[model samples]
Target: MFSRAFSNPYISKWIVQGAGIIWFLGTFGLLMYYGVGQAVAIVDALIFALFFIFGVNIIDQTFNFYVPSGRNNSMLLIFPLLFSLVASYFHFQLLRWIFDEESLYLVFLREVFLLRWAVLGMAEILVALLALAVSKLEEQKEIKNREVMMHELSREAELSQLRQQLQPHFLFNSLNSISALTISQPQKAREMVLQLSDFLRGTMEKDHQQWVSLEEELTYLKMYLDIEHVRFGHRLEVVFDVTDEVKQLRLPQLLIQPLLENAIKHGLYGITEDVRIILRAYKEQNYLMVQIENPFDPEVAAPKGTGFGLSSVGRRLFLLFGRKDLLESKAVESVFTVILKIPQHK
Candidate 1:
């Protein structure tokens, strides 16, 4: 109780101010009404202030213990009032010990102790209730803040699952390639099936994560490319030029794969000659830049894709980063290039 009363700045400040007021009143009243000497009156006031302050501090601690239990509200009031009355009686006895009991008999009989106890008790209860109300409001605000945070997390998870959905045509094409390879190249067909299985497993694992290290994402992409490489054979070639520093950086799961799929679909659908797909990842200034370029003959290849892959990637990037300029694409002659800039977080 003593520790809590002294540690609380609000309670401590009021107690100090109350003690000063008590000292001033006691010194002035004794000098005016009882014709006491200045030294004696001041000494008496000092002792009275110290003891009164101690009693008020103890009352504040007592109320603090009872305010939390709703069933103890009545007890909270009764206990402090009784304490004040007992303290007032003690103060009356102390004053008699300090001064002449015969001289101050009339003053003690005027019932000043009862009035002082009543006012002090009421003030103590009011301060305690106000502090309790403030504490309750703070707790309510924290609970509301936690609810808002949880709602946002659930929304993000739903959007992530949507973005991870596999395109139907991609699955159909892979299956057809596997069936054709099974006849003449059973070994390659078996290898492609294993690669496909690993790729899908990695995708499922990454779907549950918001972000993954660049190295892990690239490993999953490599498994996917192995399947596509077996389908196209020598006609498709992929080159990755990633910096060592960029490998540890992270980006949203499955973020880069859609861009590569679009490149392969638009760049090598009907072409016959060998074509190289180039991927470059590096840290540029404050952004992690990834660029993909592939060669496509406009005359031989079918019309460019419906833009769904790139559009979906862009939408997901905007949702994650809240920026439109992060994903960009441009085609110059026979070569199509796509660039993604992910902000580097400290």
Candidate 2:
């Protein structure tokens, strides 16, 4: 009842403010006609202003925001008019006594008492309704703003979790390669072990960072591919085609690793024919473009994929860039390609 009625702040404040303003104007007008002291009138208006600011307006907000039960809402519309009449009566009586004049007494006895206070109090109620309307509008705006902020924050948290998932996922996959090679090609496996150490150290070294330069990502990619090369030898081939200019651009850390993992994951498996994976990067228009291409066995690849790497990269990109249109995956001949467009950020 009371809770539902004052459901809007603007309405409530406007009501209180309207009451205060009427009290203000009527008090001001009466004193002007009666020629009362300026100091007293000013003090009176200030007192009412502070009263409504802290008293009615601020207090009403508690009901509106927190205890918005249907039982309590009717108080919003009920109390203001009641308070206004009481306040008006006291104000008129006070002015009558302070002026101490027969003409002032007669003014109230005839016309002023019947018309001035009642008309002015209604004016205050209307103003209060308007105030509530405006307050509700502003409140809604603030709510929407807060929702947008929360969604962005949630996405960032998800990306952070996914980002952490990459390092261990890559390590587990690479370790398997090294484990397989260790038993068969002992000397090559020894070289891979050292590369694995450097690769893991480099990846884990930048643990707290959310972003890194293109050069740093390239270094990590090269180390990873080097270890894979040592594992597959001639069975695996990788080429980097990147321009000099875009090498220093910034990107979310650990981005390329998952894409590379995807490339390798889809590029090889159950094939007597050799496979070549090409990774290329360049600047096109306003975006930094990266493409990963790999050959052989698409039908068996998706089953092993578990749908994590490239799609996760796409989600992470949207969480960061606010755009999901930046990624593309296509198959041409026996090769599968993952193309990414990262917007240039300052």
Candidate 3:
């Protein structure tokens, strides 16, 4: 059980105002009916309104202390009744003091208990019940909010795990390329290591970022391409056709890297005279469009990776935007194309 004079500010204000009106009307009506002078009746009404409001607040707090929600003890009912009786006795004495008339004490005390205290006690009980309802609702809201926050944290943890997996997978592939080059061309192998260092440094700087500008992402991609460029030499070629308008538009960091890596793995991995990887970016009305196209031998199966290539891209885009249809892939003739329709974030 808790004692409170109010549940909410608006409700408390209106309750006090309404109770004051009722007290003044009742006091003035009774005094006027008993042939009291109008001046004394008005004075009595003002004093009665003040005392009644104060006494009602005490009754409300008393009932709240006894009649709390979600509990039903017989003792709870007895406490409020006893407290109301005591409060009524004090209110009667206060009125007798204000009126300065000892003869009126018995009649006033009788009226206080039988009429005023009965009505106000019931009103106080209702107020306590209303407070209980409000408290229950607030508690429920807090619980729901906490659950949502925990769910979001869990989701972020899962995404972080997936993101963490990408770095090791990429590092392993890069180290293998460096190993293969070290046996044949030690100079190129050392150059690839330097490029890898720069690339990893850039990646480390943006490790905490979920999104970056298209230009910034492209800068990181080029750092990656520098290493692949040394590995492939003239055998691998890339053509970038991006619009100036979409250059500064924000995109998920490392979103297109896996797709580009998959393209390189599929196209120029084995037998290649010359392979061209076409990369394009532009704005299509409200969405930013990115496309990657590469040639693959239809006779041979696509290179198997650690299952974090195109699927990872699709999953990440879905997680970020809540749209499953944003990443589209198609194989037409000898060319495989992946199209990304990213919603522009303002």
Candidate 4:
């Protein structure tokens, strides 16, 4: 409780000011004792301390309005010097009036007039510099806070744009597939339309969600795959190799669908035979590791399309985790594989 009270700026300032006033009174009291008697010395010290405190407050208030900088910093010394001279003059006059009959004490005061001015000047100048430093620190803190807020706003805008782009890209492809099946297989086209509606509804619901359990993501992926299955018929096959333990872990919402879409596009395009795409997930220490495997022919050129899915996912991962190595891909022999690692937060 005491530490917390001192942490407050107003309380700390008053404490320091009180200590300084006590120090000034003690020092002047001892000095005045050499010539004046005890009662007169106490009066003299009290009056001088009042003038000293007033000079310090004036300096503090001046700096509050305009802190000197660059060429004008010389004002810092000049103001304190002038204030000390003025205060010392008034203090000496007041003492002389109060102790008109004390000739010896008057002589003592005249002798130490310059010394008192010098001491007060130094104290006031120290206070001015401290106030200037505090002002500069407050300015710098505000600037830093503004910069962080702007960066956060920029990041959120980019993430929203990336999410919006994915929906239209997948929608166009689904609409094209449905158009192709309308004449020859009207029933399948109607089924795909319904599946597409459900998938889009789920996507809209999860658009604002940043994270979800692995099981929830898998359910959303199943909806997406249902639409794809209608378009591909028996040629495309996807196998899930996820355990119950892994399904309880969490990942970014809709993060896995793009990887699966990439796998299907590369694995099935221009291929006449049936293809199997496998997705596996498990826990590896502090991270949840997910890997997708698909077979692709090197000799056959894949269909040309915008590679936005993988790139957007990579960008999203970097924005979320500040790590570029979280998403990776490689091809070995005829098998293509993509690996994604998500940090598990307890």
Best-performing candidate as measured by lDDT: 4
What TM-score would candidate 2 get against the native? 0.73
Query: Scored by Cα lDDT, where does model 3 land?
Result: 0.76
User: Tens-digit lDDT track for model 2 on 113-215?
Assistant: 5455465456545545554655566668789999999998998789878887887887787778778887888888789889889988887789678878788
Write candidate 1's Cα lDDT for 107-180 as tens digits.
74245667757755675565556545644565577699999888778758756654755445466668888999
Q: Please give, for residues 42-159, the per-residue lDDT of candidate 4 as tens digits.
A: 7777787777767656765665567688999998899889989998899899989999999988998899899989987898788777767776776687799999999989998988
Candidate 2 ranges beyond 4 A from true positions: 1-69, 107-111, 185-191, 271-275, 297-303, 321-324
| Location of the lowest summed lDDT over 10 successive residues in candidate 3 | 1-10
Superposed model 3: Cα runs more than 4 Å off: 1-69, 72-83, 100-108, 269-271
Compared with the true structure, what per-residue lDDT tens digits does model 3 show for residues 187-306?
999999999999998898889999889999889888888988988899888888998889988887888888898888878755557999999999998888999998888888656662
**CA lDDT, every prediction?**
0.73, 0.70, 0.76, 0.85
Better of 2 and 3 by TM-score: 3
- Return the candidate ranking by lDDT, descending: 4, 3, 1, 2
TM-score of every model versus the real structure: 0.63, 0.73, 0.83, 0.86
> For candidate 4, what is the lDDT?
0.85
RMSD of each: 6.2, 5.9, 4.0, 3.5
Pairs with steric clashes in candidate 3: none
